[model samples]
Target: MTEDRPSTVGVLLAGGLARRMGGGDKPMKTIGGRTILERVIAQLAPQCDGLILNANGDPARFAVFGLPVVADTVEGFAGPLAGVLTALDWAAEHRPDVEWVLSAATDCPFLPRDLVERLQRARIAEDAQLAVAASGDQTHPVIGLWNVALRSDLRHALVIEDMRKIDRWTARYKLAKVTWPDKPIDPFFNANTVEDVAKAEQLAALDGA
Candidate 1:
């Protein structure tokens, strides 16, 4: 991670049960002739100084990505917040110069290329501790920028504060929102099932929005 841009590291949260996908590494599945994880990496790698994958189980399976892998700091699957915690812990300890992390779901191949820049600018403009992307009327808490300084607070919240909801975590800190237009195809589109994978493939092949 480097402060040269927004001092942000890209964290791809791949830790999921993937019940919708009939129990498989959803990120490893195919989309547009490319693995979902590869597509996301190709899209997000340029926007940040470095990137890491957050997932449990054997890290060897994802070694091809060549980024350090971090698992949940807590015992159980505590959801996106846990992934954020893992990423924060990694950033705080390994990449001290990076103050923020830009997170996106491994399933969201269409994430806007300008995500990091837009969210960083939003956080600064709003004097907020976090910035999340929103589309339609839905708020994407997972797709947000987190302040690495919140690791201690986040850990405490997960263990002591009994906070599990992503909305609850964001509420504790100032939050800024970035909106994505409902274009021909949503930039934040995510694939959660086989059908979704097919749709994502069709969308990926489009020549223009």
Candidate 2:
């Protein structure tokens, strides 16, 4: 990071079992002639100092993205919270200067370009320890900002308490809710099914993506 912006890193959370979307990396699916992961990277890369992908299984699967892939230290597809913990640990080790990490879902192709800035601004204004993205009535907990300093506490929660729900853990902190409009297409619309991928394709076309 630089002196102008907050020292922050971006983590693409792709550590999920895509049972509904058949079986495979949902992010690898293409929308508008490009992989969803590519769209996520395109939106997030410029907003942070560095970017990494949090996933399990074979790291080679995401090699084309060329970002560091960090697997959950806590075993068993422990959900997005585990992925967040992995990013926190990775930041602590590789990006010690970065105090915050913005985690976004890989399947969300229309992620806003101002995601990091909005989250950071909300956290600062609310004096929050964490900030999550929201649209209309829905809250996307996986797409949030986490404090690197909470890595130790997060690891203990996952390893000791077996904490899997993101909301459950985030409740312990002063959390901020940063919302974006759900018009035309929700910025946080995630591709969890084949139908969603098609819808994303249409949305991508509309955005000239």
Candidate 3:
């Protein structure tokens, strides 16, 4: 990790219900002969100081990856914001040296290799409170950089304010939006269904996976 940039812990958000993918761990599904979670890890591991998985239910299912699995602090299957909060809290407690948490959905197999570097750079350049990734005119709130210091504020938003929308919460802060080219393939393409997984298989070849 670069000494100048704030230390960041990568958080793979696997807490989704995956209803569209037939109600199972979508990240565990295979793409290009490897699990999507595996692909996500391969892409993100090198960019962050450390990595952890935000997953609910029995943690044993993810033991093979050897990542520390943390369940959302809030109950009732809160949305992606909860996963973000979990990561921020985890980094604050488990990795005190880490000032930031980079959150990404586990289903995204083609996450950008320069994700951490770019997001950090953008946040610093804009002097923003948060930084998020965008592609082809769409912003991906779930895939972004978060400050560990915002854990309490996020928890209050989730528990007290009942804020489930990520965009709504992020709107409160000065957010740096960094857009990436969609040509060749969108770096943030995620597998949300069986068909998407098939598409990812083809895209994986293009990604040189």
Task: State which candidate has the highest TM-score.
Answer: 3
Model 1 TM-score, all chains together: 0.94
Candidate RMSDs in order: 1.8, 1.4, 1.1
Over 4 Å off, model 1: 1-4, 207-209
lDDT of 3 by residue, 5-121 (tens): 578899999999999999999999998899999999999999988899999999999999999999998999998898899888888888888889999999888888999999999
Per the 3 Å backbone cut-off, how many clashing residue pairs does candidate 1 have? Answer: 0
Q: What's the candidate order when arranged by decreasing lDDT?
A: 3, 2, 1
Candidate rank order under TM-score: 3, 2, 1
What number of clashing residue pairs does each candidate have, in the order they appear?
A: 0, 0, 0
Cα-lDDT of candidate 3: 0.91
Q: By the TM-score metric, which is better: model 2 or model 3?
A: 3
Candidate 3: misplaced stretches above 4 Å? none
- Put down candidate 1 lDDT per residue, 1-209, tens digits, no spaces: 32224778999999989999999799998876779899889889998889999999999999988988999888788888899999999998999988898888999878888888888888888889889999877788899999998889999999897788998878878899999885787877889999998888888788332
